[model samples]
Target: MTPRVAVFLDYQNVHLSARTAFLPSGSSGRHGHVDPMRVARRIVRGRRFDGELATVRVYRGRPSPDHQPVAARASDRQADRWSRDSRVVLVRRQLRYPKAWPAEPAQEKGIDVALAVDLVRLACEGAYDVGVLFSRDTDLVPALETVRDLGCHVEVASWKGTSRLRFPDSQLPWCHYLDADDYAACRDYTDYTAA
Candidate 1:
């Protein structure tokens, strides 16, 4: 039997990792999107899944609940027909402010927590036999462990040339590194608007 698969993407993580690894070298046609669909499809290509894709969750941080998010901001305009067909669920959270109050702390927070919660929640629900997570954050370790205990396989995907994963890799088992070609193969030229 094919294992049902669910894919989770940490938008900023892949954005930074891919940008740092591919953008600086000018390899992506300098035009691309770490398209959530493409990335997930590539990761599950050969894998068997008897059920409908469990879900494709994309987590992103917004400056304000009212602020327009980056492209994944496609969360808005959901009334359109395309959104219904695409079905990529967006999980938006507020960017955090450091308690110490850094002059400019526009960095995102709570995204890992959101992703982890959904990951373990879905696993416990038996939504998927495998959970594919795209992030290098060690903060997700505990959640991944929980999902594994629930009998869901976990796979971590990140850019190959970036930092060596500092998380519980030994337990996760499958690690997919998106290389230059993999990045190029997944680019959505239409989504490219800037360098």
Candidate 2:
């Protein structure tokens, strides 16, 4: 029997890493501007999972008003296409600021907590045979462990370019980390590029 796989992506981190590590400096497109559906397909194919793909959820936030509208449109289009073709789900959350913030502190909000909560819930509910996480945040170690203990395989997907900053095995020994670069090798950028 084929393994039933569900993929959860941390949109911001993956986007930043791709921009800083993969794309050339001074490029026009935003760093995480990749087609989530394409990435999902690449991952599923790469893993050679046996069962039908149950879900591919890409988590992201709305763009700031300052960003060009075209970018958001492209993202939505890609998401819609994925939803139609492969049951890909797009989760959008707003960025929020904490009260009594320190001066010059980085803003934090969106997906991380949501992803963690969903991962635990899904694992406990036995939603899928395997869970694929496209992020390297150590914050997820607890959730990863919980899922693994529940008899679900948790695989980490991240770019090889940031191998130095990738999650250490000491954090979650049972989980497997997949290099996104290796998966990207099989994709054709032109096919997913928005005209």
Candidate 3:
């Protein structure tokens, strides 16, 4: 039987990494956005084992409408677009604005914790044979380790030349290093900000 793969995408992390890795120098901030389903399939295909893509879980941070109406609308639209695919499961957390309001960039709050929780929770529930995390955030390492301890295989995917979680004195957790071709195939140039 083919292994069922569950892909967890940390949106900002992956987007930023992809931009840095593949986009032309001085590309716009939003240029690195990717389609969740496309990315999920690409990574699954890159895996060493023959696997079936089971689900794509996208964890994102949403801007507050009160503070940034335009961005809020764009995020909502993107969410609606992604919802068209049954395999895509989107979890959104509100962005945390700084005390200075628009002066400082709003930070993604709770996204890492949310993704980490689901990574471990889904593993314990036996949701899939393999879990593929797409982020370089070290905060998620513990949860990935927990999933591995549960006997469900855990892997990570990061843009080539970007950081990824590593285990000391062990090779159990594998990583899929996505390259330019993968970025081209998975990128979403849809310009979600457009009305």
Candidate 4:
């Protein structure tokens, strides 16, 4: 039997990294959203999985209704698109902000904890034979270890040379690197609308 695979995306984590590495040096932060579905399909294809995508879960923060109008639309559109994909599942948390928002605003407070819980819970429940994390955040390491110990094959994907982790060892998941071409192909067609 081919390994049943579940892909979990740390949406903001990956998005920020992609923006830093894939966006042209000075193009502004407008167009770096990668199609999560495309990203998952390409990774699964490369792995030659057991032919099942048990789950494609993306974790992110839903901007509160009062967020800046323009940027929030793009974020909402991206989330909506992902939710509509037959193979993609979205797990979102609320974004928190102080009464007086900072210049950069706030990030999703509980997303990592939610992801970690789900990863371990799903693994224990036998939801998949393989758990592949599309992230570089070391915060996921403990959960990955627990999943591996529970007999799930754990793999992590990141931009080539971007992760400082040395993996496939007893402590970390087996590692794979995503290159520039992958990002170029999966990047969002329209990440922003001109004002």
Candidate 5:
């Protein structure tokens, strides 16, 4: 039987990483954006086991409307579009704003924990045969380890030239390094910022 693959995406992490790896210097945040379904399909196709894409779980922090109205609207539109796909599940948490407002950036408070929780929980529930995480955030390493311990096959994906989460036990947790061409294929060119 072909393995069922669930893709877990830490949206901000992957977005920033892809921007760093593939976009031109000084490009805006909107430039390197990727369509979640496109990336999930690309990842599934890259696997040697002939996996079927079961779902794409996207974890992201919603922008604060009071602090950044334009960004908040753009984010809402993007979320609506991404979640329209039947296989995509988008989970968004409120972003933490700084006391100084525009002087400092809003941060993602609980996204990693949420993603980690689902990663382990889904593995235990037998939601998919394989879990592919697309984030370079090391905070997720423990969750990946936990899922692997539960007998769920797990893998990590990162843009070329970027770091990926590593397992303590050497040789475990294979990684798929997507290069510029792969990034190009998954790019979402929609300028969400445009009115």
Candidate 6:
């Protein structure tokens, strides 16, 4: 029997990692931004899971205009495209803190909580046989444990050196960890693009 897989993505974290890890240095460089949906598809393919994709939920905070305009546009376009696809679902929430922050900070709020809540809810509902998370936040440890206890397999996909150090040891024994570099080979970029 093919396993049903549910994929949950932490948009800000994944995007930040991609931007920092893959994009080239320089203010004028075209940011090499890979489509998140495309990245999700690539992850699914790399996982080689048996069942069809049961659901794909991407969690992102609404973008502020002060952020990189071009990159933001590209991300919106990609997300719009993904929403039209049958296999993917986009879930968005506003970042809690915008004021009193740097003009261009790398972090955001609410994504981790959103991901965690959805992961546990879906697992408890028996929505999927496999749960895949594209983030490295140690805050998700409890959610991972709950999903595993529900008899669903959990796999985490993240950049090689970008993930939280405590994640590996904190995860349940059955949870699997996949380094993003293993799956990002085809999407490498030599230049940075503003986002």
- TM-score winner among the candidates? 5
lDDT of 3: 0.90
- Give candidate 6's root-mean-square deviation (CA, Å): 4.3
C-alpha-based local distance difference test score of model 5: 0.92
Q: Write the per-residue lDDT of candidate 1 for residues 144-170, one digit (tens) a residue.
A: 778877877777787888853334435
lDDT by residue for model 6 over 1-195, one digit each (tens)? 888878788866765676666555662323444455566666667775565577888888655545545545655666676677776777775444445555645445777787889899988888888888877677887888788778878887776556542344454333234354643653434332333
- Our tally of clashes for model 2 stands at 3
Candidate 6 TM-score, C-alpha based:
0.73
**Global lDDT for candidate 6?**
0.65
Identify the runs in model 6 with alpha carbons over 4 angstroms from their true place: 27-30, 64-76, 101-107, 164-195
Give each model's clash number.
Answer: 0, 3, 0, 1, 0, 6
Model 2 is weakest, by summed lDDT over 10 consecutive residues, at 97-106
Local error of candidate 2 at 59, Å? Answer: 0.8
- Kindly list the per-residue Cα lDDT of model 4 for residues 25-143, writing each as its tens digit: 77766667788888887778777445467779899887776766666676777777777877788888778887678666776889989999999999998888898898877787888
Q: Arrange candidates, best TM-score first.
A: 5, 3, 4, 1, 6, 2
Candidate 3 structure quality by residue, lDDT tens digits, 1-195: 888999999999999988888878899887889899999998887777899999999999999999989999999999999989999999999999999977889999999999999999888888999999999888888898888888998899899888787666675478899888888988888988899
Ranked by lDDT, the better of candidates 2 and 5 is 5
Give the backbone clash total of model 4. Answer: 1
* lDDT winner: 5
TM-score of 2: 0.72
The sequence of per-residue lDDT tens digits that candidate 2 reaches over residues 7-85 is 8888777777666666678865543356666666666776744555678877777543234355456555556665785
lDDT of 5 by residue, 61-118 (tens): 9988887889999999998899899999999998999888668878999999999999
Cα lDDT computed for each candidate against the true fold: 0.69, 0.65, 0.90, 0.78, 0.92, 0.65
Off by over 4 Å in 3: none
